[model samples]
Target: VDDLCDRAVKASFASAGQGSYGEVSVLLTNDLAMCEFNSQYRGREGPANVLSFPAHLRSAHSRVEVEPLLWGDIAISFDRVKYEAKCEAKPIRDHTAHLVVHGTLHLLGFDHKEMLDIAAMKRLEVSSLARLGISDPYSAGVNVELSAL
Candidate 1:
């Protein structure tokens, strides 16, 4: 899981034009904990597959250079991942990989709040997943060209 997450984070950062060095904390929890987090943070009722909390960095002038910056935190619901994988008819590993990439992208300031934004973010996500040998998760009749990513 750690190795797959490392690859996903690296692929996401590379696709988003970020440096190789960085830090991201990942939490693998079950639905009970995830449900609480969803309610507390997102104000949603149910657990999400994954959620990202970006560590908004201070200004460049106020920080000191030392090690890789702590990008953010990502919480993934194992229960949700399993359920979604079965429902979507995708391999569990692939689904997990896609979610990790998705959460990493959110930490990098990417969002899918709007139509255009969704397209752009999805492109980057698909590209990153491709690097990990995972197919696009949104290939539900909507085609996304990898070359454009």
Candidate 2:
């Protein structure tokens, strides 16, 4: 999981034209915990595959000088990710990597609220996943159940 998180983060930074010198928390948890977070933060009722909470909010107010930027926290639900992977006919590792990349992009302030934003974000995810040797997640008949980030 740690290795996967590292690769996802690196890919995200590269795609975003940023240097990867920050710390991001990757929490691998279960469905119940994720449901609670989803409800509390997003006002959603179900568990999402992944969730991101950016640390920029803290840096915006803090005066401390840190070498590495503290990017954010990403929480992933193992059960949800697994289910999604199976449903999409994708390998679990590939699906997990995609979620990490998605969450990292969210921490960097990338969102998909609008059509243009969705296109841009999807392009980044596809490119990053390709670098990791994964195929385009949105290609052909693939259906990815994405959550609101």
The candidate scoring highest on lDDT is: 2
What is the model-wide C-alpha lDDT for candidate 2?
Answer: 0.83
TM-score versus the correct structure, for each prediction:
0.85, 0.89
Clashing pairs in 2: none
Predicted candidate 1 versus true structure: per-residue lDDT over 107-149, tens digit per residue: 7777766688778888998899999998878877633221110
Give lDDT tens digits, candidate 2, residues 1-149.
Answer: 79988998899878876667888889999999999999999999989888989877432113335524688899999998889888888889999999999988887778877788888889999988888888988985776667736
